[model samples]
Target: MAEIKTSVTINATQEKVWDVISDIDNEPKFWKGTKEVRNISKNGNQISREITIAFRDQKCLQDVTIVPKETIKAVFTEGVIVGEKILTLKDMENSCELEALWDVKLSGKMGMFTGIIKKHIKSGTEQALQAIKEEVEN
Candidate 1:
């Protein structure tokens, strides 16, 4: 699997950070890899959606679950890639730590390119984290 993990220390409370991340519709604003989002359904904190990814503008189906101020887990169910991406938040004395973990790999014949894509994914994740930090702090 192509796994990428990254984190950012935001100068804001968990609640503040949660407010920013939980706005799933605004994901494309911070995550460049995610070009667009279309919600399919919603039940409480769980949502089913299709997200357009930057890679060939591929659309992936995802089942996302939000755990209040703790975590956001998105499981990719279909498309060119499959696996999960999780966002976790840890409260600190004066700020909060936001961590993003991606465990995904290209499907079918494209699997061979997983290693090559890892670098792009890692860089995108780091950039996304930095964007989030700037959004929250300023």
Candidate 2:
């Protein structure tokens, strides 16, 4: 399993940050790599959505587990390789720090071409972090 982790400190409260992150329907607006987010269903903290992600034109059906105001875990249930995203928010002094950890395992021909995909994923995460910072601060 390959993993990518990135973090950013936002000049906002944990609750403020959580408000933006918890909106499962607006992921495409804040996440640069996400082209669209279609809600499939939701039950409590668990949600199912179809996400069209940037690069390689990958469309994935992902199941997301959300812990309101604290954490969110998303696992790919269909398309491409198995992937998981874990997001955690921490309160620090007068600000909040958001950390995102992404783990993915490639399969078939896609497994052999992970170098290119990894770079895009990393860059996308960085952009997403920056977007989150802007949204939370403003």
If scored against the real structure, what TM-score would every candidate get? 0.98, 0.94
Error of 2 at 30 (Å): 1.8
Tell me the deviation in Å of residue 100 in model 1. Answer: 0.5
RMSD of each: 0.6, 1.2
How does candidate 2 fare on TM-score?
0.94
What tens-digit string does per-residue lDDT give for candidate 1 at 1-138?
987888989999899899999999999998999999999999999999999999999999999999999999999999988899999999999999999999999998999999998999899999989999998898
Summed backbone clashes in each candidate are 0, 0
Best by lDDT: 1
Question: Which candidate ranks first by TM-score, i.e. highest?
Answer: 1
lDDT of 2 by residue, 21-118 (tens): 98878888877778888889989888898888775668899999998788999998888858798889999999989998989866677787776677
The Cα local distance difference test for each model comes to 0.94, 0.86
